[model samples]
Each structure stands twice: as structure tokens, then as C-alpha cells.
Target: MKAGWTSKPLEDACTFINGLWKGDKDPLKTVGVIRNTNFTKDGALDDTDIAFIEVEVKKFDKRKLFAGDIILEKSGGGPKQAVGRVVLFDKPEGDYSFSNFTAAIRVKSPDELDAKYLHKFLHWTYLSGVTEGMQSNSTGIRNLDGDKYKAIQVSYPSIGNQRRIVTLLDEAFADIATAKANAEKNLQNAGALFQSQLTTLFNRRAKRATHTTLGQATGGIFTGPFGSLLHKQDYIENGIPLVNPAHISQNGIEPDDRKTVSGETAKRLANYIMRTGDIVIGRRGEMGRCALVTDAEDGWLCGTGSFFIKPSSRCDAGYLVHLLRSDQCKQQLENIAGGAVMPNLSNTDLSNFALELPPVEDQKQIVAEIEEAKESVERLKSIYRQKLTALDDLKKSLLHQAFSGQLTQ
Candidate 1:
């Protein structure tokens, strides 16, 4: 801050803009508040997948927006830090109305402090001191009302310093964006390269080995025949990692979307434990989608919708996952797909499935090569990921410092 410049608290500098329902406004006919959904990590407002309310309500529910105001999400709570999610509202049309889930901030004067600068300042991690760990009325709905917002003390720099901070944010975000893009591209390249290797390895001519059912190749086979009701309502967290046909991924399972079971209920159903090297096949939606458990996890259980493929001999789990994900395997599985809306592969068909088995030595070599390549790719990805995380942290730090008046020449 400049030596002679005086700064005020947020309470004095800004006021909350609340829109009262206008008379004769029919909440039903009128579109409800627009939400600040689809936010970017850098506090950019992403209205791409915008949602709206159609509920009929009184006119007072609509909150109007203006240029230079900050659009803040009402609900808080998540792995995502909610405070400082400052969005600079700059719609030239300004046609969108805000929902009850958001608050609008109107600065005292746009000329005195740039809207962009203020928005960025509000996003600093220091704001977490103001909003983080706050309580909410309901799940997924977090509220940081105007009162707490006012008590926050802000250290203001000169207009010039604010502009400088904004510029720094812009530069930092640009670099972060570029790095993110590159990392994503790299991840795709890694997957493609691995899939290509599989294709090359499996595309060659080999004598068709004697075909046998998946049951014939494995020593044991059993699904969750418990008839226990797991109708999506029974899923509970920290209980069990439930895999169903819907979760089958070429690479493995979508760890994020799995259902959970209670420890007590899962204890009685422990027979369903999925072991390492188990090949899990989706028998319903996305029929024939398969993934191998590269390693074992305790309490990991599969629902009846998934088919457990047990190998008759000690085979490479990585090799099997790659093979199942290969184009050839998918085509074969798809041909056998059956179901009205959600197709599935029956055990009978799986038993007759065949693959041109490579020599044991070749299988070993291929697995080793793939492991090395994948490890390198993963390591590189981890580096970029860490860098991206650090930069984001830096951004938050700068914002906090600016508002606290610690950011000075």
C-alpha cells in the first residue's frame, strides 16, 4: 500500500446486494436464480453447464446482478475449499438473475478499486480464515452469510498495488493453465501408447489355442449370490468398496464412484472379498467392460452385477487387464452382449472365450516393458501435478497477503 493511502474494512468498503422480489413477478413464469456453477480452480466463473430453477415462487426470490459485483456460491463444504471463491461478474448483457444459493457483492466504487482486482483478492486462502470449516444447514449446501463477510479485516494497498496484484494473478493463472493442458495431453499420450503396445502384441498370428469357458480356465468362481438387497439404497461409506457392472473400466475401476457398505453388514458378507489378480467384468450396463485388480484392497467387494473371473493358472494380472481392454477383446465381448436396456455377458459365453496365449517368457517380457513405460509416465505426471498444486497454493497466499496489507512495495 502507498504510504499516504488509507484503507477501510470490507464492511465499510462493500455492501451485500439483495434483490427483493418485485411486485407482479410470478415466480413460476419467471426463471429462478442462475447459479455460479461450473467454477474453475482459478475462480473463473464457468456457466457452460448452467442450471436454472423452474419452481413457481414469489417475485422476491430473484437476485439481480450487476457488472463488477462478485458472484459467490451460497453452499459450502467439500474437498474443495469454498471461501474466496470470488467471481467477477462482467456480463455485458447482465441478463442473468442470481439464485438464493449465491450472494452478490457491490463495491463502493468501481473506479476506486478494479472489479477484477477485488475478485482476485477475495479468493486468497486467507479468506478461508473467514469461511472455511463453517457449518451448513444441509448436505452439499454451504452458506456464508453477509455478517461473517463483514467482520473480515482487509488490508488495502494503493490502487496501483491492487492493479499489480491482479496482473500477477493473471500471469500466474496463464502459466498454470498451460501446464495443466500439457499434463492432460501427456496423460492421454501415455494411455494411447500403452493401448498401442497391447494391440501390437496381440495382433500377430498364432495358432488358436483350444477354447474353454472362463469357468474352465479358473479354479473357483462365485458371485454375490447372497440375494442381499443392494438396491443402491444399501450403499454406505467406509463399509465396503462395491463394484458393479457400471464401474467396469478398461484400465480398472472408477474408484471414485463405487458404492460403500457398512462394516457390520459387510462383515457378514465377507465372502464377497475381491482378491488381487481378480478380473472383474461388467455384466450389465457397458456389458463386457472389464478390469483387473492390480493389487488387493481389504473390504473390496463386488455386487451381483459383476462377474468374477478367476484364472485357472497363475497368470499376469496386468496382462489380462490389458488384454481385456484391447480392441479385440472388446469386440468379442460385445458380440456376446445381451440384455434389453442394459446388456450383460452370461457365464456360458465367458466360459467359451479364447485368447491366443503368448509364451510364458514373452508374457513376462511384455509385462516388464509395459510396467517400465507406465512408471515413467506416472512419475512425470506426478511432477506436473505437484507443480500445479503448488502454484495454486501460491495464488491463494498472494490473495491473503494483499487483503491483510502485508503485500506492499
Candidate 2:
């Protein structure tokens, strides 16, 4: 429960300043940007990946921003995901302006509520209850304005309590950050070690390694593409997902932003359907590298630039994925792709490449070990991610209490 603190209408606490919520018409070749991408996940502003737009700032005077003004992303990414992301402008130590799609909230009533505390609080739940109630302006764009934000009901214990809560949150989240950083670093190092191990295992016995095409090592290798029926017109920002070589990775597949195609398109392209245990080998640009499709992604298709491999009973899919991603196979792949602007390999060409068939037991053992190690690394990542999430929730909980005046002794 929140601390029994007095409450104030948001309208009585802050001033909302917003400019044109339109995309640039006559863009400038150079400009300053106030984008949410510049903001890091930890609530700090980072501009390393920002893009410039054409604009003459002198003409868009009201578009400027100032210190203590909190900027909110009106629309971004997917629904229920990127909406309501908040960024407080505390950098450049000077004036700036919000983007056309963003809104800025500035406090004029410093007496009623602490602006810093409110910034923290608003960020804590800007997407909480408010996001669900928001109506999308377009298929995926949702706009959040000052009026809705100001109507947000908030209560705090006191300014002193709010500060204490913020302090506690900062300390706890800092610890979580350090832990997460270390965990992620360890994951990277472990993955590298695994890759190196695979390299040594195969390259060491190069002379003894018998060469065979991917087709010889497997039952058959075939290309994916439900016959170009999934044309460009059927693709969309929303719908059934299709995974191409770009979607596959050494670590694993990530379908977070996987491309979509219409249901009709998918039906026509049904031949590309990925089975639970299907192993996909890249055929274009760095061909022969592979990734396995798991039960979680049975619905998706192994789209273009990918070849599906169904190995004989002698070959293990897990072992093959690791081997394909290894350096030896990469060399073979490069041999074919040599000196080409686009490294592309066909299924017939891939069938000519080969490697030793380790005993089934050895293959099983190696796959088991790799799986165990990867699971451990993923577990470590999960723990750290949870810790980070909890720390954030704790800060919000404390904010709820501190303003309610219950956090004090």
C-alpha cells in the first residue's frame, strides 16, 4: 500500500508544453534531435546512435526544450511495448526541443510536488494503467498527451520521503546494473570460448577430416521459399512472422522483430513452414552457418537465404548446427563465396562440402555439454534480468509509499 501521504491533482503540479506532432515536411540537412533512442534503459540520456534531421531551429522556437522537462515518446515500436517510454531532459545543460511525435511535461508548481520525484514517478508507471487506455492513432502509433498525463492520480508521503525512496532505488538499481553487466560479459566470454572450442575440435584433425557435401552428411538439403507467393505486397508491420538468414544468429534465433506476412500469404507459402526440429543453413553471404528451429517457433517459416537440412539418422542436428557455425565450415563456405560482393551458395553447391561423422555417442555427448553450458549462461542472464526488473519495481513501490508518507521511521 502507498504511504498515507497527501495527494495533489497533476494539473496543479506541472505545466505541459507540446509543439507540432507532425513529421518534418521541409527537412534540414543538419539539426539537433530530441529522440527517445538517445535515452538508455537506465534512464540516462545517451546520444551515440542518434540521427540528424534537417531543420532550422530559429523557425521552431516553441519546439525547444529546457531542463526539468520530461519528454515522453508518443509512439514507437510495437503496441504495449515501446509506448509511454519517458526521458527527462537533464543533459546538454541547456535548451532543446521535443520531436513532433513526443510531448514534454514541465513543472511550474514546484511547491505542490517535487519535479525530480514526479519525473521518476511518471516514468515508473507512464505505461502502467495509462497505456492500456490509450487509443492508437494509426495501426501501431499511440499518442499520449499532457491532458491525460496531468489527469494521472498521484500521492506522495512528503518531499523528504520521496528523496529517501529515490536514494534507496538508486542504490539498489546500481547494484543490479553492475551484476547484470558482469553476467552479460561472462555470457559473451563463454560463447566465445564455445566457438573457439568448436574451432579447435575440427581444425586440429584437418588432415584426417574426410570432405563430403552437406547433402552427403545429411538426408537432404533444400532451399526455402514457398514459391514467391509471399510477395512484397503481403508483407506487413503485423501478421505471421517469417525468419530469414538475417533472423538466424550464432547464439540462437530472436523473433522479437521478426518480419510478418499475411495469413493468405503464409498459406500460399506453407511449404516454407519450419518444423520444431528443423535445422536451417544459410545459403547467401556467409553460407553454411546454421540454426535450429525449436518447438516454440513451429509456426514461423524458414524464409529466403536459408536452406533446410534433414540429416540422416547418423547425423545430429545440434552437433551439425555447432559444426556449421564453426570456422572450418566457414572456410569452405568462403572458398565458394570467395571475392564476391554477395556471398551466396546454392543447395547443390553446399552438398559438395563435407566433414567427419563423429560417432553418434560423441555427437550426443558434445551436444549435451553445449546445451548444458548454454543453459547455465542463460540462467545467469535470467537472474540478472529479474534482479534489474525487481529493482525497478521496488523503486516504483517505494515512490508510491514515500509520497504516501509511510516510508519514514
Candidate 3:
């Protein structure tokens, strides 16, 4: 809509080539093929996991990719991600082609339409939600409507002006990318600092502390009720909360009210009820996922896939929770865990596991220090995460300005 800029259908500006597919043939040839998985979220080819598969010779000849070609994802998108992502094929002309789920777009005339400029415009459209209306879902996979995508209105200035816009965008995006990377690294450092504190504080005290098996330090390990003992029919709305593995998060219990049982069912499973200061830990799948039970969750029943530990007077519950969640303990448990499909912990193995126990007072002090360090680390992570989000927003805003002919002049 800017002065002297003309708008035309994308189909008129470029020729679209449907991608290649492997066909049944006696003799075959292998070539590097780019699939949607090779497409990065940043609209670039990853090239690290390109598939080398055999396809019909004739199909490969017509669909092979070249430098300056734009590969468009016409299918294969999730519920959270939209279809119609376009990535620039910057690699040299080689024996490479895209999958059938994608297509290649080549500018018909470089003199009139700049390929880079067109690719940028399409990228902007996808980011701006303009292509959301141009997609439909089938069999849980989102597909871009080819006819609608071809009819997309692309507004552009002269080739000279388009090249100038591309130059400006390229430089600006490079700087933004650097800033985002720094923010991300800072976020990682924030988390690493907390983990370091846990490792250092625990490992340092562990050297001087008396060692004992978990069975000697705790009252007893109570495994959750088996699936046969707790039937699905026992679960009801607005009933006693059950502390399942999913409910254990960030060193604390976060029970889902929907995953509850009736008072009668809780009474029947009273042996599995958690007490205040008890530690609920996941016994299956991911290791080191454990939480401290608060006063509010004292009477909660431990659901299947978890084990509750009641710390004796000698061991501090908070200290024991942190120890169970530590990387060292996780690795130890993984070594003994068993299951054909998913790793699981046995009560006998967990009880026999050796642990370094500091005096109750010393354990509480370490827990307090860790709690303090966690607060500072969380603050730093929040700040860096905000910066990364702002950088993404800025990139989208600049793209909106560029395609609207407001980037320059």
C-alpha cells in the first residue's frame, strides 16, 4: 500500500513445485530428502537429520531443491503449531529434494520479484496469523489449503527497494538473534546456579555426616495402593485428593481435585494416607520427582505410581525431600530401578539405598539456605525469560512493518 508498490497473487509471482515421494520400484537410488522435521521453528533448514531415501528417478528430477528456493510446509502441524511454515533453501543445487508434505516455490522472474523478499513476506504472513484461515485439519494433521495459499496477496516495491528492505531486515535480525542467545544462556546459568548450590551444600556436608540406609533414617516406606486395590470406580468429584506422580512438582505436592476418591474409599485405603512432613516421590518413569507433603495434604492418599516416606525424629522431612530430588540420588535410583517399558523403583531397593544423614538441626539449616538460593535463581530466570519473549515480539513487529512497506522510507 506504500507509494509505487504493486500487489499481486503469489501464484502469479512464482511457480510452485510439488515435492517428491518414494514409489515402489525394483531398483532405487538414495538422495538427501528434507522433511518437515528438518524445518526449524525459526524458518530455517536444520539439515542435521535429513533423510536419505530412495524415490522415483523422474520425481526426484523435477522436485530436487536448489539455492534460493522456498520450501513450504503444506501439511503436518500440531494443535499448538499451524501449518504453512516456509523455510529458505539456501543450500547449493544438489541431489536433494523435499518430502511430499512440502512444496518448493521459485520466483518466476528475479528481475521483478526478489526471492528473499518473497520468502520474508510469507514468513511474516505465517507469524501474523494471516495463514490461519488458509488451513484445515484432517486425521489430526493440519494441512494448508493450496488454492488459498496460492491466492495470497503479496505487496512489493521495485526490486532495488525490495533488496534494500532485505538488507536492513537481515542485519536487524542478526543482532536480535545474538541478544536472544545471551538471554537464553543467562536463563540456563540461573538454573545451573541453583543446581550447583544443591550439589555443593549436600556433597560438602555428606562427607562429614554419618551414613545410614534409608530404612534406618525413616519410619518406613509406604508404597501406593496397587491398581487392583484402588479401582476407577472409587474416584469421584470433590473427594479426598490423591497424591499421584503428576501431583508431585517442584518439591511440593500439587494435587488435582479431579483425581480424588470418596471418603469411604480413603478410609479403605487409610494405610496409604500421607502424613504431614511426609515425602511423596514418583516410583515410575522419570526419577528424582518428589515433593514434601504440607499440613493441608496430610490426609491425602498416595495414588499408584508413587511412594510416601515418613521421616523419623532423627531426619528432617525437608532435608530428605531435597536429597531424594538431587541428581546423585536420581542416578543411584536409576541404577537399581526396573521395568521393561518404564523404569520403576522397588520399595525394598529404596529402603536399602544408603544416604548421608546430617544432624536434624544441620539438615534444617541446609534446607533453609537452599530455599534462599532458590528465590534468587527464580528471579534471574524470570527476567531472562521475559527478555527472550520481548525479542520474539520485536521480530514479529519488524516483520509486520517490513511487508507493509513501512520498513524504509
Candidate 4:
């Protein structure tokens, strides 16, 4: 809407070229084809994961990608991810073409339009939800409407103005990227520091402590109801919660709202009722995922994918949960876990696993220390996470300003 500026549909400004479909071809003689996987989330070309396809030299000559080509993802997006993701190709080494799931747009008049500008604009559109809104889903595959996408009008000033905008955006985004990377690294370091302290505490304690089987230290160890006793069909909309392995987290037990069973079904599986201070370990899937059952999780029916460890007076429940989460204990459990399809931990395995037990008072002290350290790390992580979020918002704000001609102003 500025003086001497013009708005035009993408179709008027560029020509769209479809990519080649995969066909029977020898890998040795075929050229590399850029699939949708080659497009990074940031709208840049990723050279990794390129596929090769055999095609006639004539066909290859016709479909070969050149520098400044903008490839758009036309199909094969899921519900959460939208189609119409675009990436700019800078003509890498070797002959390259794109897949049929994508289409390339080449500026009809390079003098009037810039490919990088178009690429940035399209990326903004995708991020802004405009492209996602234009998508149609069929058979679980989301496809972008080519005609609607082509009709998307973009307003721009002179090519010089466009280049200036691109330059400003590039510099600003680079700073933002660096800031984000530092923030992310700091966040990761915070978590790693906590993990290191945790490992050191457990390892040092294990060195000077007496070892005993979990069964000797715990009053009881029981697996959840077998699949035969509790069927998925027994789940009810509003009933006693069924705590599955997925609900167990390093922090604590997190019961799923969806995995509830009727009172009748719960009574039938009453033997697997969880109690406060019970240590619940994932019987399958991820190794060492365990949590201490709090008062809220007490009386919850344990699902088939979990094991409940009833801690005796000899062991602190919190300490036991931390021990199970430690790498040494996890490795021990994994060593005995067996299943053809999925790793499983049985009651016998749980009862036989060796645990280093210290004095109950010492265990509580260690748990308190670990919690304090985790809290410190978590606080730092939260701050850096907020900073990262702000940086992302700043990037989006800059993009909005750049595209709207506010940057040059």
C-alpha cells in the first residue's frame, strides 16, 4: 500500500514446476531427488536424507533444480503440521531434482521479484497459519490448494527495497538465532548439572552402602493386573483412575484422565490398588521410569504396564524412587528385562534387583538435597526457557514488520 508499490498474485509473478515421481531406476545411475524431508523447519534446504531415482537424461535435464528455486511442500502433512512448507534451494553439488510431493516456483521476472524474498514471505505465510488454513485433508494426508496458494497476493516495493529488507532480516535473525542457541544451551546445561549431581550422589552412596535385594528391603512387590483380568473395554468415562506407565514421570505419578475404570471393574482388579509412598516402576517400554505414589495417587488401580513396589520401614519411598531412576539401577533392571517385542520387568526381576540401602535418616537427607538441587536447576531452566520463547516471538515480530514494509520505514 506504499507509493509506487504493487501487489500481485504469486501465479502472476512466478511459474510453478512439478517434481518427478519415483520410478524404477538403478541407484548407481540415478540422480539425487529432494523429498519433503529435505525441507528444514526454518525453510532452508537440508542436504541430508536425500533420495536417488533413475530417470532418462532428457527427463533429468527437464526437471533439474537450479539455484534460487523455491520448493513448496504440496502434500503429505499431518494434522498438526500443515502443508505448503517452502524452502529455498541454492543449487548444491551434484544433479538434484525434487519429489512429486513438492512443486518449485521460479520467478518469471528476476528483475521485478527476488526468490529469497518470496521464500521468506512464504515461510511467514506458513508460520502465520494462512497456508495451514488453505490445506485440505483427505485420507489423513493434508494437501495445499495450489490454486488458492497461487492466488495469495503479495505486496512489495522495488527490488532494491526488497534486498534491503532481506538484509536487515538476515542480520536480525542471525542475532536471534545465536541468542536462542545460547539460551537453549544454558537450559540443557541446567538439566545436565542436576543429572550429574544425581549420578554422583547415587554412585557415592552405593560405594559406602550395604547392598540388598529390593525384596529384602521392601514389604511387597506386585505387578499390575494382567491384560486378561482387565480389558481395555472395561475403561469407563468417570471412574477410578488406572495409573499406567505413561502416567509415571520423574517428578511424580501423573494419572491419565482417559484411563479410568468403573467401580465394578476396579473391584475385580482390587489386588493392584496403589498406596501412598508406593514406588511405581514402568513394567514395560522405557527403562528406569519410576515415581513415588503420593496421597492423590493412592487407591488408583495400577494398569498392566506398571509395577508397584511397597516400600518397608527399612527404605524411604522417595529414596527408592530416586534409586530406580539412577543409571546404575536402570542398567541392572534392563539387564534382566526380557520380551521379544517390548522390554518387560517382572515381579521376580524387581524383587531380585540389588539396591544400596543406607540409614533411613540418611536416605531422607539425600532426597532433600537432591530435591533442592533439582529445584535450583529447574529455576534456571525456566528463566532460559522464557528468554528463548521471547526470542522466538521477536523473530516473528521482525518477520511481520519486514513483510509489511515497516522495516525499511
- Model 2: per-residue lDDT, tens digit, 160-183? 776676676567667767776776
Error of 4 at 207 (Å): 6.8
Which runs of model 1 end up more than 4 angstroms from their true locations?
Answer: 1-7, 18-33, 51-62, 76-84, 126-130, 204-221, 229-278, 281-302, 314-316, 325-354, 397-409
Query: How many clashes (backbone atoms < 3 Å, residues ≥3 apart in a chain or on different chains) does model 1 have?
Result: 12
Question: What's the CA RMSD for each of the models?
Answer: 5.2, 5.7, 2.8, 2.8
Candidate 3 is scored at a TM of: 0.89
Find the candidate with the highest TM-score and give its number.
4
Reference-based lDDT, each prediction: 0.64, 0.67, 0.88, 0.84
What is the Å distance of residue 350 in model 4 from its true position? 2.7
The per-candidate count of clashes, in order, stands at 12, 21, 0, 0
What's the best-to-worst order under TM-score? Answer: 4, 3, 1, 2
- Rank ordering of all candidates by lDDT, starting from the highest: 3, 4, 2, 1
lDDT of 3 at 320: 87
- lDDT of model 3 at residue 401? 90
lDDT: the better of candidates 2 and 3:
3
Q: In candidate 1, what are the lDDT values of residues 371-395, reduced to their tens digit?
A: 7776876787677677767766766
How far does residue 191 in candidate 3 sit from its true spot (Å)?
1.6
Q: Per-prediction TM-score, please?
A: 0.74, 0.72, 0.89, 0.89
Question: What's the distance in Å from true for residue 171, model 2?
Answer: 3.6
lDDT string, candidate 3, 229-335, tens digits: 98778888778998878888884788787889998888999899988888889899888899888888889999899999987998998888888888778888888
